[model samples]
Target: MNDAVRELYSENRYPDLSHPVTDISRLWVSARAGGLERLPEPAACRVLELGCAGGQNLLPLAARYPKSEFTGLDYSDTAIRKARQASYEAGLHNIRFEAADLEHWRPSHPCDFLIAHGVFSWVPDEVKTRVLDLCGQVLSDNGVACISYNTLPGWSLRSGLVPLVKALANNPAAAGLGDSVESVAASLADMAGGGTAHAANVQAICRDMVKKGPTVLPFDDFAPVCDAVYFAQFASWAGERGLRYLGEARLQDNLPDGISPHAFDRLAPLATDPILLQQTLDLLSGRTHRNSLFCRVDAMLEDGMTTGVVMNFAAGRGLVELPPVESRVVGLFRQLLEEIAPSCLAMQELVERTADRLGAGWEPSRHGRELTGWIYQAARLGGIELRSEPLEIRSHSMAAPRLSALNLHFAAAGRPVVDARHFPCRFPDGHERLLAAMNGSRAADELAEHARAEFPELDFHRWLAHLAERGIVE
Candidate 1:
């Protein structure tokens, strides 16, 4: 980390900063979906996190995969303190947090997966290069790395706010970074006043800045060295460092669904090359942020699905039944959703269940193919997910569900959200109370009795089953 970078975070302290996507399993699955080679499984893989503030992002993952080893490094002492305290409280023995600058730190052993989210674009060029260098030095042969940064065309517009923010931030009377940025935003909106086209544009931009919240306003926008890299240049830089650009962590971004057919057709021929197509897409979509993945130069990134790929839902959104082109599969799909909705089941389990539901007369081989296609189509539509590992289901003899240590800790600490198999769950009105009350001693009846104080109509058993379906209740 750069001295100024360290000083900035150490002073202001980014509150509740964690990237849920940084989970190695999520990255591996995304990379595989993008047609990368087989990578290490999450269970036994060694994972490392750069700029891991308070371990909020990494600790939950650590708790989830206790068999895996996790290491979190950050230059800020305050970040290390909070992260260490949380680890102790959660009783996570497989992970360690250290306060060390990236410049001086070296990995003791090659890691299967590494992540550096929200750290790439904020530091100096030298540190950015050092990040790539460390990835080259430490990543396993088949390892995948996720590095997220602000990209161009999208940043081209947002960058205009930087100078305005810096100027106002210089004002001594301004309360702080958040306050100064807010002041500048208001002033810009006032100056725009909305009569001219440019004025309306400025006001829209101000609205975006306002929604970014206080932490982002100071650290990302107004910082002295906030840099934005074009996707092509970033890819070239990675190539120079002996790493090959794989794809984005968000699988949907790599697909062609976001743009119009005419626009894609026009741009496609002009940039026949895949890398150039990526740059063109950035321009077409006005994409400002990206979560990128990379692998060793020799690694072959095939352009199709890998065999035996496993996926699971990240959260429970009422499962959207696939649109019925034929009415025969509708009831079966609905039943399938009901069975797997509560837990993350494997692809084979899904196929078998579909076959069983269709009855003994149905041929398993023929129907399995049809069901697989439907499930994948549904997954592409966000109704299901492809998991790199099976969801870790916990066993409890009591009627009340046993929530994971991390989820319980998060709920007790008033963290408005928690992770369920890499999906985020925002606490509903009485959800936190229900989660916090699962101390291993509370049975379903006792939990319902406790929950009735705040939620008179709450059914603890149904709620427990709901949480189980989302993988929130262990």
Candidate 2:
């Protein structure tokens, strides 16, 4: 283990701070499940998140799938503390967080869904093997595990610079690796003369780092502790552990159609082996980030269906149903949906019917327009149903539209609103009211007080849980 890197992570330092959301996962899962295949029902699914930092990704999932239980584990005490604090502040009972070394920690039970983001490439080889072994041992027979990592080719260029940067830092005495990296970066920037080739190269690298900004992993803490693996090695390792590669979490990364005709033609022969083909494609494309799904050989792929179908059925739509929809003058909605899937005859008919009902020139309500677009794509691909009713009038709201209304509706209904909207029962009603009240103005405590009045039946803790799930008033 690189003590420097371990120290860096120990201090809760990693350049990238972003977390995963099901909205993004839904798209990937939908694409992998054959573009529109209905997902398996979400109820009572057990999920485990490895290296779940501060519960940023897992907590929202717990809130959304109240029927599903979630557990998150991380090695960092600081991160565990933050995650626990966030969960406590939110008042969530379905989610649990624990700090444990991945090598020895054992799950009390098998998980139906497993996720390990930003950990595969950082842990030591022994720890990585333990993680893969745990996934195989603890994942339910029908479970799906998402593992993200840094790949080769693209990292070839970036990784080449790591040694140079570390050498330039030269100060072993620096208390923090971040301080060393910044010092080196600054020195390189200063040495780059007015217009020399060497200076230009330095400037270019600096410029790329700046553009990547938050996306780049900082050296101070993370650089010393991380280990990146090639796609081929990773796939082979997991395959040995009884996990078969499903597909990339980012669906677009797997589409040969997106590659140049010549590249696609050259890579086409490898398609017989999905893992090899994807690995080669990723290498060819110089992919830096990937979310790969895996399952046991006997595990059936999740067909994206769920009870939320009732919401669509109640709305008089079918698996192929499309609601009336129109683009804004800017065609933003149209463009977004177009990227989703090709329009089908059923969708066109629905649009025509809606146009007839509202005048031909009528523009769809922003919420209606976005929802229709998502539903149209989902239907075309047979993905999960886009349930839930409208909350915000427009897409560009301060709070998530789904969170605002769906959460409140669930609280009012006195039960989970499984099909309330695009997301599962992630939000509660009091949070929706609080979101409306905040509009980026109200203080957290003030919002909590207002929620107490509106949902007297819900205690302060419940309201806080709703608030934490949405990351509102926090």
Model 2 poorest 10 in a row by lDDT:
387-396
Candidate 1 clashes between residue pairs 3 or more apart in a chain or in different chains: 1-102, 310-387, 311-386, 311-387, 312-387, 342-469
* TM-score per candidate, chains pooled: 0.81, 0.62
lDDT of 2 at 189: 61
- Evaluated with TM-score, which candidate comes out highest? 1
Instruction: Give the poorly placed runs of model 1, Cα more than 4 Å off.
Output: 1-3, 165-180, 183-205, 256-258, 261-272, 300-303, 306-324, 327-335, 359-378, 392-402, 411-417, 423-437, 442-470
Report the CA-based lDDT of candidate 2 relative to the real structure: 0.55
Give per-residue CA lDDT, model 2, range 316-375, as digits (tens): 222343344454422433333343332222333334445554455665565345545465
> Candidate 1 at 110: error in angstroms?
0.7
Candidate 1: tens digits of C-alpha lDDT, residues 18-50? 576676766777777666675777888899998
